[model samples]
Target: METAYTIRKMEKSDLDQVHEIEQLSFTVPWSKESLLYEIEQNLFAKYMVVELEGKVVGYCGVWVIMEDAQITNIAVHPDFRGMKIGEALLTFAIQLSKEMNAKRLSLEVRVTNYIAQSLYKKVGFTVGGIRKRYYTDNQEDALVMWVNVQ
Candidate 1:
């Protein structure tokens, strides 16, 4: 069954939950302060959150520049995993990128994260390249996946 949820532009107040999900979902998470900067100061960055029953359950960030949009992060709360929220968030991101007039949308995912890679592949993304030692904590290679939106 599809979950009822709301996806909206992330606000300053969402930093706590967003950061919480970040910490829970990644080996090296973005700090609350950095998320605040992205919300308030980054000109090209757009952050969004997904709420389930009025509580934030996931978030995604993207930097849309000229003809391209790059996804910075996307994660669902640990408790909410497998509810399809991440896929919803990703679909929203791709649509958002197209609405922003970006011709392509891309993101870097740790090569070992087959779950996320499969989700991206389900959404028309194809492996484009690799970033050597892209993850700081484990020195893991990241696969660059991209989809043409235009």
Candidate 2:
């Protein structure tokens, strides 16, 4: 049988699981404390988690500032990759941004991460520029992409 998944606002209780996916997905993961601060203290931040069978399986975060929304981070648990969870999370973020009156949505993906770049492109993002050595893990460059969501 197939498992069902649902996406909802991120809560303090979800940090541990969200951090787990962050560690699994990135070379430099954000600390759990940072996640907590974003959820609890950051006024411009919005985060959502995808739960599979009542367990957090993926998450995405965005910061809406004025007319633009910038995706801060997004990840799916290693065990949940290739299950369309990432796409759903991103799609939801886009909709949420629009509802918040954002006219454009943007994100940065590692230049070498072609799979993620393709996925972003598939969802209407286009390469806008490059941030040289944007990633501290290995000094990897990041490609900035954006889409008009309004």
Candidate 3:
């Protein structure tokens, strides 16, 4: 079910490939500097990269605190969209969260992102609530989603 991919903790050397995947996956991607800061400054943050044949194709990140794991972002290269790579990355994130003793996982998804919603649902996330004006660019509402790890 994992295809040919392997998930491992992210490293500084993964920045370039991660940037490319981020750009390809999102309308407004996080800046490389911001990512670097997260890696360097966020003690709660845990990031992982998905590799296939020794090449990075996707990544997922979360911040674990007490009983919560807050998913920050996840992305897969455009060319690999239909390969179940996103689900694999998310599974890897969830396993990492459990390893860190998190009791739950949470995230915010744009209301219009049905594809992503489906993926989250497949992984056991459920719609929990909404945040108004969650996206600055389009004033889109964000659907809050959560999954209990225990």
Runs off by more than 4 Å, candidate 1: none
- Give the whole-model CA lDDT for all candidates, comma-separated: 0.94, 0.94, 0.90
Best model per lDDT: 1
Against the true structure, candidate 1 reaches a TM-score of 0.98
- After the best TM-score superposition of candidate 2, give how far the Cα of residue 118 lies from its true spot, in angstroms: 1.1
For 34-109, candidate 3 gives per-residue lDDT tens digits of 8887888899999888899988999998999999999999988888888998998888778888989999999999
Which digits, one per residue and each the tens of the lDDT, describe model 2 over residues 29-122? 9999999999999999999999988899999999999999999999999898888888898899899999999999999999999999988988
Q: After superposition, how far is residue 25 of candidate 3 from its true place, in Å?
A: 1.5
- Candidate 2, pairs of clashing residues: none
lDDT against true structure, model 1: 0.94
Cα lDDT tens digits for candidate 1, 22-81: 999998899998999998999999999999898999999999999999999999999999
Please identify which of the two predictions, 1 or 2, would achieve the higher TM-score against the true structure: 1
Off by more than 4 A, model 2: none
Worst 10 residues of 2 by lDDT: 1-10
